[model samples]
Target: MLNTKKLLALTLTLLFVFALIPAAAQAAPVYRTLDEIKADGTINIGVFSDKNPFGYVDENGEYQGYDVYFAERIGKDLGVKINYVSTEAANRVEYLETGKVDIILANFTVTPERAEKVDFALPYMNVALGVVSPDSRVITDLSELSADDPVIVISGTTAETYLIANNPEVKLQKYDTYANAKNALENGNGVAWANDNTEVIAFALQNAGYTVGIPSLGSQDTIAPAVSKGNDTLLQWLNDEIVSLADEQFFHKDYEATLAETYGLDYEDSLVVEGGAVNAK
Candidate 1:
């Protein structure tokens, strides 16, 4: 019912809008597999940039941590150049689902709900929730925390989920990164920071005047590599890699190389996961 020029203009506007749709949105979903990834000769791996001892960048600007060490070995065995992608805990699943990275080695904990989203390859480390607070007044009990004196937890971590699910009344001050949460804890933002026991223990070890009062707060779990869902070829390769590495006592070597300084010989036997199982090295 419009004039020729107006009708033409309206049709062109519609065409332009359609053309502006992102190619990714318009095309069928593309899932990357092992062969396709290998053909590219570079594997993108996601790891935390701020979490220390487990995954972090050193002063020399080189990424160094237990998970990063394991990721380096995967690149070597696969004969591919490794591309390190710095990821946050909250974005670990997103990075895999969107193909931003081929593998997540950022100390990803295996949980049934998370398993539904990404395929966990094999466990390389064992972890459980622990709380750290100022040595002056350690927080050993969760009931001690109130709304005004809450606990700090990293968003998208098992600690947050566990607390929210099991203890709905527990108040939480959630942060996106470990560094931020650590700073908050130091600045008296919360009574304590609840995180992986290894991380908290490392923190207490590295810094004075802080201690892990609650060394083991939640259920024990395993840390493993995660690939995009339905990535069977990649998952199988990773599982095989885990077994092959175990035959060499590689996880023990990994602990010696990365985790030893923080935990020492005392925890060496209790924390390492060998051959995809929770076995002390």
Candidate 2:
């Protein structure tokens, strides 16, 4: 009933529609599975290059820190080499979503909001907010701050989110990197710096003339590794890896090797979470 030319046109339209189906399916973000990563012989990990005692680069240009130590162990266990990718606090999610890095170990805190975007492994560390300011005029309380006195916070961090949600009246000076936030505090760009208690405590210990006026703020939280959303294979592997490492007391060893020099032995029990058991003795 159809002319030859009409039939030809209809066939071409069907082919065009079918061609778009595969292209559309491929357009979604792709993540490597555990088997695929093993096949690749190298797993890319995202970490901060400036956050010391957690994730940073040494003068020798080698990546070194608590997170880096864990990353190294992951690589060794997976029988793969590691490719470290420097990531900032704000870009951690993007790195995972785009497959730029297979895992994020940059002191990433587990939050319900982040959980929606990335799959978080079991916790490896505990954390809370703290404020550090010059000893000359310590800010012991957020209420002590004047409306004009800005608090320094790193963008995309829980500190920023907490302050914004809890104390919207307080002014904030947001920086993109830990180094810049530290510089701003040193240069008196803000009245105080708000960040993870571990970091502010480390700062107060390492540098002179600064004190953590409020040593603990907000609810206690846990830090964990994160992978792309729906990457259940890697997520399960990381969870199992963490649990297996507990038998050997791996996280405690990690803290002693990297953080004890900064926080001393007093904090080891409080900060380190062994085998993903947050409340384990």
Candidate 3:
């Protein structure tokens, strides 16, 4: 019913449109790299806004914590401005994956499951699981805790997972951050608070009425700076920086300066990371 010349022209147009579709679909979205951050004169770092002794804002509304100290140094070394993004334990990885932060300096533990999602540099700190209870009535053994007694832990943390997988009967009262869980424990909301041993030890030492019963749980692991997956350039830069710090025992100095007063005993060798440290071994 159509003219031959007109049908031929329409067919050619359809073919041309189909060819352009593949080209458009094949176009890749531009992703900024670590080098781009340096060129832009600003590096955004993600940190926990409420997690104390690690990352928090002081009375003056200025960020201050062990992690903040490290972030400042990274910015200084890079000769760029530092922008802080307040994050939570659960959101740290999402921040990196979405390019919301160039690096996550928050207290992110290295795990096999998480390693698949992001790249981790050499460890700057070491940690294990621990449980905390009131000094007046501390729990020394896993069997000591009552089946009815609810244990407070941050949701999605290793603490919750460890108890769920290992101790089936233990009741868990999960919160989202250290501050909330600390408050719950202070109010006698739970029988105990379980988390990274480093946090529990610090809390017990700083607050007079609390004590850490389980000093170590599970395997020893390291905390490292994390970047988005496939971000080898940024990961390499962080690794190099960490290695350089190891050579001078920078984290040792960091612990003495920031955490020593919180942890009464001399724990330099236990908590600090020395030069030539590697986790792959």
Best by lDDT: 2
The C-alpha stretches of model 2 lying farther than 4 A from their native spots are 1-27
Candidate 1, poorest ten consecutive residues by summed lDDT: 22-31
Which lDDT tens digits does candidate 1 get at residues 24-129?
4554434578998899999999999887787899999999999999999999998999899999989999888787899999989899989987889989888899
- True-structure RMSD for candidate 2: 9.0
The TM-score between candidate 2 and the true structure equals 0.89
Cα lDDT of candidate 2 equals 0.94
Model 2, 1-281: lDDT tens per residue? 46988999999999999999888556666799999999999999999998888888999999999999999999999999999999999999888878889999999999888998889999999999999999999999999999889999999999999899998998999999888998999999999999999999999998999999999999899999999988999999999999999999999999999989999999999999998988743
Query: Which candidate number has the best TM-score?
Result: 2
Instruction: Show the lowest summed lDDT stretch of 10 residues, model 2.
Output: 21-30
Which runs in model 1 stand beyond 4 Å of their true positions?
1-29
